[model samples]
Target chain A: MRRPMPVLAAGQVHEVHGEGDDRAAGLAFALGLGTANRQGAVLVVRGALRQGLGLYGEGLARLGIDPARLLLVEARDAAALLRAGLEGARCPGLALVLLESEGPLKGYDLTASRRFVLAAERTQTPLVLLRHAARPQPSAAHTRWQVASAPSLPLEAPPGAQVRPPGLPMIAVEALRWRGGPAGQTWHLQWDEQHGGFRDTTGSLGGTPNRNENARTAPSGAVLPMAALRTG
Target chain B: MAVERDAARHGLAPGMTLADARARCPDLATLPHDPAADAALLTHLAKAMHALTPSVTPDPPDGLLLDISGCAHFFGSEAKMVAKATEITGLSTIHALAGNPAAARALARHGTPAQRRAEDVAALPVSALDLGEAATTALRRAGLKRLGDLVTRPAPTLAARFGEGLVLRLRQVMGDVAAPLAPQPVQAPIRAEARFAEPIARTDDVLEVAEDLLRQVAAQMEQRRLGGRHFALTLHRSDGARRRLLVETGQPTRDPPLVVRLLRERIDSLADPIDPGFGFDAITLSVKRADPLDARQTGLDQSEETQDSLQALIDRLGVRLGQDAVLRLAPADRHMPEAAQVSLPAAELNSSVSFHLPAMPRPLLLFDPPQGIEVIAGVPDGPPLRLRWRGAVHEVIHAEGPERIAPEWWRQRGGHMGEGATRTTRDYYRIEDARGRRLWVFRRGLYDGMENAPSWYVHGLFP
Candidate 1:
């Protein structure tokens, strides 16, 4: 059964935590939510991390976010990241602000999160905080989500074909906390590039496991998938 | 060693050995010569001479040439202009007025002040030609000791005897031929200044004067249907120290209040606050760069207002954080992943470049140089069955093919088939592990059985 994807309200602060090596999933989820409306430019303030890679424009375009409408600010430290996030959230011209950080940020305490909430409320701008390799902490966020990568369904091929490629990018998101709604609801969603939104892909064969089921315990690892025959 | 008037009176001259000069005057004081410092001082003096004329060329070592053809009327006469130039430089100057640059340079350096007339160029010595030592000595030996003697000689004979260089120099010095003068390029001044009789020390007072000057400049820009992108406010202190404060905008703007706010932001962001050490006697505001910005009516929709607000926010943040801190992503037409996008400063992004989406799925986060990983593939050219990365092992559940991407051979150091090529072909795959963690990994080289074994690397993470 398909479940309705949780909607993140505007004019509030929301947190997304990456589980294990799923930092990219968290970032992609936040970007999907931020660029959902396609209203105005999205401001992304990123703090320094151990990883040396940066955001790629081709990937952003493929994800349905216009590269031209993306404003990026690389903060040298945590304090700068908070400052840029607060300032961006206060601006009425931006549609959304995404603050990405790694590990435990020093200055992003409850007080700083409250300031961001206030600023975002004043401007009616949605603020999405994407945290990688960080634990859940006390904050003023209206909702918090724990996100991790999920295996996608393979594309259908002819009877004689030897291989089937992966379909779309999929993720398993669990609602850790909701301000006024029921919490702890898990959903397996896949990015639909044609519609520019996430589609619920739970309970399908050869896809992700059922909701709340640890993906490591799934029984789909025994079958050996055929090698793809196409070459670039 | 250059001697002063008193030392020259005691028979000491420039270019003399220090021992000989000290023997000539035992009490003589000497200082080491610095050509770089001399050039810097000359440049400073040339900048001060801008008040006399817009066209001022610094003649190297120790000379300045000013093209005062039409600028003489600014000071009522050429003599007063020369006096003003002398006063501004605060140095002894030998000024000359002539028709051409070469004649003027020769007359100023070699001729006497009484011979400043155009016809008196002939009376100058043969050294005025400046044709180097050998040419000058040959000219003197040929009985042409003066410029008058060279001018009377036939041109063909002179060219045949002393080479074409001497004849060209003779014509240039005699003003028969014109030589192009490379003057320092100066921008048209769009500035306003206020001079106070009594120096003011208060910060508020200085800002008030600055506001007044900004208003004047804004009005001038409005008249020309233009807007300023960069503004510089210079404060001249009574003790002769000058302080400059600069502010730039993301878009052209002439609104005084907006500019004043930016100026205030610039002042506050300064590492060391502006100090009115001895008070400021004058303040000048100049528009360093101006662009044509036509007036537009506000639309009923909020789009225009939103763009204006966005620009204002960019300028504000750029002033506080730094210009480079605020950036916009622009697409680059390159095949390589890292070179596919460029981050440019927000203020300088005039046009939006759209990105063309690739046919293949690209990972959201791409490692700059793909990190190496240990892979256990089923075959040399087949997909990986298991891989270990960052001290973690993962069993591959679903794997995709080798999407081969060759290196850009045209961008190689040598020819396309060069022997010392470092970059190898890569075959990428999108793989999902047992835990459903998707990764984009690549094999470094092919298994053609002619070279070493190929290695695998994890390039990016899929969401």
Candidate 2:
């Protein structure tokens, strides 16, 4: 049995990217769920206050995650955004920090990335670098994911019209690089809006909604079923 | 070239050569004149006098003008205040009081008694007018050795002969015209001082002294129901050199320990460390800016303390790494994406200014100068079809806008007609390249000859 774990373990630097607000919201929700004790805040380094609020507030709420634990800090440039992330990591009280910056940031060189990794390790905090429109580059991050909006399974349509409100957001995520685990993994994770968490739909092309409703154990902590192992 | 009163009695006048004065009086003692050193000492003394009154201006060369209008009563009376000043200044100061600044200044230098009469100022020598040597010589050569003689002359003739300077000086000294005294930057009313019995040189000792002074200031601020937003620490060294350190907080605070820690960080990070040359004879801490500090009730969860600790961290970092080094990006009330947010010093950010995230979908990264690119478009006002940026050509697969934004006419009025001001209307577009990389592009200016031909620029990137 196998399970897809969304946990960003301590000291690991995770890189995630996608279109619009899902990247930040998905990561915050995943990281928030993994940590049993929510004593520290989840920092988001991004501008556009309303955008962050909408994504985190609505997105987290849909996943049944509390949005109050998220804190947004705006930075002037990519380098500043990285510095803010590193500073946040130095605080042992912080659970995770997400640096949402433009990809191919000019000043974020190898040395700067290494410093972030080392600082995260020292403070026992996980860091996620979310880049936009950026090409893959060598970094100290432990995992890298390329995410996109997936066509969610349509909800039961009313009679002949077949019209329905948009389904819960589903992200098609590809693991481009994984340091410790299997690389080149893919998954279509549907957000369980009412549960405030994510559900793995790797069993079938159109997995029945809430297939993992009864299996509540953390995937990394428990054994996974055979269907989830198809793509890894 | 100024001579002591005794030297003047001995016929050694100002403008007299040093050799001539020494020749006239075989036992005459002379020391080199240091104008810079004198000004510094005068400023230090004036700061010390701030303990007596807030309005103390250094009347350079060797005097301070104290405006004790309503403050004199603090020491019981004007006479007692003067007595207190003499005591504080170590009996070296000569005090005088008059109705006007010019009169008071002239009387103080001339050792004239406290009298507001115009005739009393006139009785003093013309040198008391503080006119330069050329004008003083011109007045003396005209047989007007006393201010009284100069004032008695016909006003028009005096103006014509000695120029307007002498006439103005006569009117000022006689209290006949208004003369504004530019006071030293007024010191804050809340301050604490400590004069050491023995000068201390070690860094630890200096910090201890600063901490003690901070405690006193913090207590005073507490009594007034205020917190200090800015603090200034002035250290008067044993050799008379003074060093001042200033630190500003993100929010008003009355916590002495936090204030001391911030000051220590500032001192430790100075490019040139605070050298308590020989030692520091006196140290003063002043609350340069104070704000009303209402008591905050913290919930049992201690959420407020978390905010305070975060602010304290920012303050400490700001002091150590220079205020400009630590910055926070805040929303600006401008439509231009680059101008939509501003970077402010972390220390200057207050809790009062709420930063609302802009509602519009702005790009993740904005080009600071908005780099221009060569573009091929169907129509002048349409989205870019293919653009050459940074020497590479990007084919536009899908495009989304002609979001028109006009130049602010009110800003153009009375503003320098520079490149930014002369900008015409802009049409922005959110375009996706062939590789699915999203870019925010714009066409600057219009084809209607409002500015140069419409040019293309890649303004930002969408993540």
Best by DockQ: 1
**Over the stretch B1-463, how does candidate 1's per-residue lDDT look in tens digits?**
4557778789888899999987878888988889999899999988777878888899988899998888999899977888888889887667777888898888998898678755388889888888889988998898898898988889999999999988898898877888778998875678999999999998778888888898999889888888999999999999999999999998888888888878887887788988899899999999998999888788999988888888887887788778998899888777666677788999899788898878988888888888999999887777788999988998887777678877766787775685433347788988888667788899887676776778889988888
Where's the lowest-lDDT run of ten residues in candidate 2 chain B? B351-360
Q: Distance (Å) between predicted and true CA of A13, model 1? A: 1.5
- Each candidate: what lDDT? 0.81, 0.67
Per-model TM against the reference: 0.71, 0.53
Which residue pairs in candidate 1 collide?
none
Best-fitting candidate, measured by lDDT?
A: 1
Model 2, B138: alpha-carbon shift in Å? 54
Instruction: After the best TM-score superposition of candidate 2, give how far the Cα of residue B91 lies from its true spot, in angstroms.
Output: 33
RMSD of each: 11.3, 16.2
Question: How do the residues A1-232 of candidate 1 rate in per-residue lDDT, one tens digit apiece?
Answer: 2234656678999999986488888888888876666488888888867657777778888788878888888787887788888879988878789999889988887899999999999988889999988989999999999888877776774354345566688888888899877577666677876677676554444544543465223222333232121111
CA lDDT, candidate 2, residue A206: 36
Per-residue lDDT over B1-463 for candidate 2, one digit per residue giving the tens place of the 0 to 100 score:
5677788789998788888888999999988888888888888889889899888888767778999988988999988998888877773566778778888888878745533333277688888888889888877888888887877779999888778887887788778898888888863589999998899888778778888888898888888889998999999998899999998888998888888888887787688988776899999889998999976667787666666655775676567655765555555677555665666666666632444433443554456678889999866766677899979898775566667877765677655454565466678876655444556788887686554677888776543
Native-referenced DockQ of model 1: 0.51
| DockQ of all candidate complexes | 0.51, 0.06
